[model samples]
Structure formats: C-alpha cells, structure tokens
Target: MSVATGNPVFETVGGDASAATVTPTGRTTAGSLADLAAQVVTNTTDAGTAKANAVSALNTANSAAAQATEALSQASKAITSSSANIAGGYAALDGSGNANVPGNMAVGASNSGARSFSIGHTGLKDWIRFQFYTGTGVAANPDFVFIGMNGTGNTDGTCALQGTAFQPLSSNTMTLGSSNNAWSGITSQTAVDVISDLNDKNIIGTLGNATYADVTAKLRVVWASISGVVYTLKSGQSGRQHIGVIAQYVAAAFKAEGLDAADFGVWCSTPKKQIVTKAVDGQKIMSIEPVYETDGKTQETQETIRYAELLSLGLFCEKLERADLEARVAALESKSTSSTAA
Candidate 1:
C-alpha cells in the first residue's frame, strides 16, 4: 500500500522518477526507531535479570539440601549415643554388666555413710538385706551380714553371719519347734558318757547264774536305790508331762530276761512313782544310745539299751502273765475232772 498525498502528482511512465515531490502522511523517523531500539535493549536486560534470579534460587535450594543432610547425620549420631546410654543403664540395673552383683541387685534409701544391698521382694517389709557396717572394729570388712525381715515390721527379725556356714548372729537363739520336736540321730558323746557313768553306779550283779528267786531278790535292791518324790513344775517351765519309770528299775527289769511268773511278779511289785531326779534327767529321757567298743568289765562309752528294750520287757511281762493264767486254769480243770471221777 502507498501513502496518499493532496499535492498533484505527475504520472510516471513505468518506473520513472518524475513524480512531483509529495509530502507523505506516515513515515518512519529517527526518534521512533531510537525508541524501538531502547525497548529491545530493556527487554533483553529484563530477561537476563530473570534468568539470573532463577539461577540464584537454584543455588539457594542446593545449599538448603546440603544443610538438611548434615543435620540429619548429626541427629542420627545423637540418637545412637542416647541408645547406648540407655542400654548401659539397663545392664547395670539387671547385673548384666557388673561382676560385683552376680544376681539381682537393688539400692535402698541411702543413709549417712551406709548403704544396703537387697534381694528378693521389693517391698520394704519383706526383703533379704546384705548390710555392711562402716563403724569401727571389725566393721570395715566389706563382707556383709545377712538379715531376714518380714512384714511384721518389728525388731523380731533374725540376723545371720555371712559365711560358708550360715549361723545365727551372736546371742541369737534358734528354736527348732514351737513346742515339742523330735530329732533322729545317735546320742551325742556327752550323753553317752552320762549314761555310762549312771550304768556303772547302778550296777546290779549279773543275772547269768541268778535263778528266778535270785532275780526277784536283786530287783528289790534295784528298786530301793531310786527315790520317788512327787514335785510340781515351777512357773515358766514347759507344761509337758514327765511320767517315766526310774532308769535303774527299767535297766534291772531288762536284765531279768528269762524270769518266770514269780520273778515277773516281784519285778511288777516295784512301786511306780516320780523316782527320777534332775541328776538322772538325761538317762531317763528316752533316746537311742550310740554303739561303741567296750571292755568286758568296765562300762565303756558304748551303745546301751534304748526305749525298745523297755518295750521288749513289757512284752515279756505280758507273756509271763498269760502263761501263769493258763497254768492256773489247767490246775483247776484237773481238780474238777478228779472230783467227777470219784
């Protein structure tokens, strides 16, 4: 398209430059081109600034990522350290780490210059305590004395010495039973000695050659030696009944092994009473005697007859009584038959 002007124009023969000078309404000027060049430069500068800003943001993001990775590594190390401490604490409490505590261990409330190692139940009322004294004179030893306390929470607990053999503390008495108790074992040497002494003193002549009449006469002498005196138990004494024949009487009766009814009758004639005294307490106390070697004449510290001997004597007496009754019946029947025949 060509611009139109009001000025008259001469028609140019094909491509001729003879056109009158025409003033064009629209034309490109130097100032407008300059403005367009400035706009292009401004756009390029803005695009460059935007690209630079994007690059800067990418660098900032990379730095942030690096810092986060470092922080995560530090946190992992801290967690591992904390876990190790926790594991150590657990080991200490359970005796898994310390050799001093071979089993379970617990620390009680601390007192001045004192501490207690406890085992068993955690309740303060019922626990076994290993107490170490820090005072003077034999207290510095780390070996603890064992103490057993119960929920009663009184001073009525027991303390034992810490040793290979568990023994009660000094001056502490251990009772076997609340009342009567039984023990099974050979009598002690001291008891044997006491019995030997008694046997020697109460020696009735041997019954080897003695007839039934002689046995009866010897038993009388043996019975007379004992003094039977009835006495009441003093206050605070054990309420157990003390009923037993004198040891000498039982011993002499045992010696009359093959006695007839008449001899047994003499043996039974001995008065029954509290003939035993405190002096013969051990001898009369029913117990099995220990067996030992003895010379023929001397009463050595050897085995003597026990309660079973007394029982045997009792059986003998019963047999003798039964034989006597049968004999009396036979005599009576023989008399009746003789009378009927007459």
Candidate 2:
C-alpha cells in the first residue's frame, strides 16, 4: 500500500518499506539511500577492476620492454665479447668484459712529407686512426687523426684516408688528436685479412692499451660515439613521436575491443598537440571538440598515470623489479578512487 500525506500512523504495507515487520534478514527497498551507497560501491569496484587490469597490462608491456632492453644489452655485450667470428675475425674482448683489439700495432712514423698511417682491429669494428707526420722527426700536430674503414683491393684501401695534413711522430707511439669534433663516413667493415694486412705494414698504429682487450674496448667506444640514436623534432611538436608510435599500438587494441569513438569520452592526442574531445549532438556524433562549453561538453581529466607508468618502466625495464612497479600502480589506483569518491 502507498502512504498518503494525511496518513501518519497507518501501516498496511507488505513490501520492504514495512517498519512494523520484524524479520531475521535485513529489509530491502526499491528506492532507498542505500541504493546510492550500492552504486558508489559498484563504481568503486569497477574502478578497482580496471586498475588491476591496467596494472596487469602495464606489467606485460614492462616485461616485454625489459626483455627487449636485455636483448639489446646482450647484443651489445656480444659485439664486445663474442668469440664468434664476423667476416673471418674473432670478437675483441677486454679484461673488464669490454671488447678490445690486437697488440703490436704502430701509430706514427718518422718519415717526412704527409705521413699517414692506419690503425685498426680485426673483426668487431671498422674505423681506424690515421696519423699524419712530417720530416725532421717533428710532429706538426699530434692532434689530427683520421678514422674510416680501409677500402678493399687498393693501396691504403682505395686512398680512403682523409687528408688534413700533420707533422711527424716524436716518439713512435700515437697520441690524442683534436678533441673538437670527429670526422665521419668511417663506413663499416669486418674483414680479418684486410685488418691483419693493415697491421703488418706498421699502419696498424700503436695504441695505449696494454692488452688486446683494452684496445678492442676503446674501439667499441669510438664506434658507438660515431653511431648512436639521435633525433630532431619540429617546432610546437613535442617529442611525442615515440609515444605516438606506442599509442598507435594502444589505439589498435582499443578499436579491436569495439569501444565507441564517442559518448564514452576518449581523448588520445600527441602531447603538445591540441586536444579535441568527441561528443554527440542529439543523434549526430562528431569526432571534434564542441565549440560551446555550455553545449554539454565531456568532462575531462589529465592524469599523471602515464608518467607514473613511464617512470615505472624506466626503473624496471632494464632490471627485473616488478614489485616496485606494482606498488606504485596500486598507490595510483587508490588515489584515483579516493578522488572520485570526493
């Protein structure tokens, strides 16, 4: 029965709203304040599940990233320490697990008139140091050194040496050249016969390494310095290119799940690029930000979630520490729910 405005003491209800009924179980109601509590609990439960799922996904990504990073590291180490042959040469290695070169290589010569010598190691690396010298046994400049791969089947490797011209060798050993900027086009080579031939002619050039490993380690350093990952970004364009690539992968996953492009509120733009939220106008849904804020705009929130994830990735990618990342994700998920409740 329904209660009227004039009825204050009448009770004929057999439903959950009955106050006179005494039962072993708790009373239930179709419309009560407890429903709001239940809704809040449900939303919280959903967020919790989403958070757990996100953390799981992040863990997967991080695990993959860690595997990739480890693989790269192993590759680098192998390049430095592999006894495995490349183009008929052994892997150069040093005492500290670093790669090195062979011994008995000479650097400078006491001859006059544009003396150029080539210094290199077998396998593992391609560039060499070219020392210039003059007559009268005087070094015009010990700071000028040339680096490049020796061309095959030619005198001094097709005369591939750069000519900046310098003085003669003072001692019989090589010295540091200019510390300014190094020359490029060093190319790539991995032939033992060619490198050994260079060494036999006193063109191998003497280095400071006491052992073959030290020599190879030094050569590896030069190689990385000459060739490493670099980038340039356009004006107003954040360095989101890398993230954009990753996000594209994320987007494909999102679409595969059949998520609506509108109504549910999804905003994924390259950082620094203008963000446009998607919305619906009656029956017409456009994939652009509404011109009018009062025209019922989508509620948006910029979170540090990605940042936390990134930091987590950076911290655990190279190493194997999942506990830390899990803790951080948990804290973030807690904060997100707490804020929603507030």
The alpha-carbon RMSD values of the candidates against the true structure, listed in the order shown, are: 26.8, 43.4
Model 1: per-residue Cα lDDT over 1-342, one tens digit each: 243433332222234233223322353322233354566799999999999999999999999999999999897766442343243332223336533433355564432223344355544665576666545666556555676765454456655556454445753377332212223234444643212356456555443234454764444444344344344445426564544444445545446554332333232222212222232423323232322235434322311224444444445545555676899999999999999999
Candidate 2, position 327, lDDT: 82
After superposition, candidate 2 runs with Cα above 4 Å error: 1-36, 39-45, 48-52, 55-66, 69-77, 80-342
Candidate 1, which ten residues in sequence have the lowest lDDT sum? 270-279
Question: Candidate 1, overall lDDT?
Answer: 0.47
Model 2 TM: 0.17
Q: How far is 9's C-alpha from truth in model 1 (Å)?
A: 99
Q: Give the candidate number with the greatest TM-score.
A: 1
Off by over 4 Å in 1: 1-240, 252-305
Clashes of each: 0, 18
**Per-residue lDDT tens digits of candidate 2, residues 1-342?**
554433233334554543332222233433343454566699999999999999999999999999999999898766433344343446455558854344344454433223345355445245556664534546566444565665553444533444554435664455332112223224446632212355456433233334544543343332222212234445435664323223333334335445321212222432221224344443323233323234445433221123333333234332323554788899999999999999
